[model samples]
Target: TSNAEKELPDAFLRRCVFHFIEFPEKDLMARIVRVHHPDLDQKLLDQTLQAFYSLRDIDGLRKRPSTSELIDWIAVLRRAGIASVELEAGMPFLGALLKREQDLLVFAEA
Candidate 1:
């Protein structure tokens, strides 16, 4: 649950049971996305997931977006009627996925 494991005290760490969860692969993520957005267009979902994963790959990101953020970003896109074609040019509603200013700036520069 913590991003800063080094900051925790030894006593606190000793009492905790840590389990690392790997980020979902594309197929698993697509299935997860469908659960929240069953009727979403296939092309849009594919493109969105691609962009999301690409964002996560960016180096020096202070806070990479999570599944929750991806869901939120897709929600905004759906509400805004964003088409898959638009995503090819640039990601819309990026703020939903990237909360940190530094992260956003890094993405922009990339």
Candidate 2:
């Protein structure tokens, strides 16, 4: 609407198309996780997904980790030979999830 009309240039708006999407539920998140880590065990995938949700729920994060970040983090952990997801063990790998130094520092103190 009105806000978009005023904020976006008419030329740009004419060429742009938009769609609204519902946020994916837990089961969809599980499928996304599996897609990125096909060989990951089911139990581990579930745990990883829970960790992702928990991380997103943290208060006052500068840039909360999203599903795409979760995939990258899981890949990094897998490469590091992490067989299970523990918050402490995964702490060092937050760079893959968080993009901002401020967010990393805030997360460390959490």
Candidate 3:
């Protein structure tokens, strides 16, 4: 199941690169969503994200999601915008991959 989830994203990125899309950094948030709600709908995530931005200022920093610290990820991605769908996925996935303060840098690096 986990592998399937991972591959869905891997395939999307490979396709993006093939098509010459400029994948952005926002995709990182998807990682956080996968951790809490692996089956979370991309559409609902989109809605949650829209709600996120609609509630805040364009240049303002979000206070973070109320559901979980992990959900703070949704904020990170929203701030980055939609061009980075792949990076959105990476946020939660990599967040899980690197929990330590030291590894945090690695997660960002990845």
* Model number with the top TM-score: 1
- What's the distance in Å from true for residue 15, model 2? 1.6
Ranking by TM-score: 1, 2, 3
Q: Model 2 clash pairs? A: none
lDDT of 2 by residue, 2-110 (tens): 2422487888778878666665788998887788788887766776777777778878786777788888888887788777645445554778888888877777777
Worst 10 residues of 3 by lDDT: 57-66
In model 1, the worst 10-residue window by lDDT is 1-10
Model 3 over residues 1-107: C-alpha lDDT tens digits? 21321355776666554434332223555565667656555775865545433323223222322235436555454455533445444343334223355445433
Please, what are the lDDT tens digits per residue for candidate 1 over residues 1-110? 77542588789889999899988999999999999999999999999999999999999898889999999999999899888998899988889999989888899898
Candidate 2 stretches with Cα past 4 Å from truth are: 1-10, 85-90
TM-score of each model, in listed order: 0.89, 0.77, 0.30
Clashes of 2: 0
Give the Å shift of residue 18 in candidate 1: 1.4
Report the number of the highest-lDDT candidate.
Answer: 1
Q: What TM-score, to 2 decimals, does candidate 3 have?
A: 0.30
Model 1 CA deviation exceeding 4 Å by range: 10-15
The true-structure Cα RMSD of candidate 3 reads 14.4
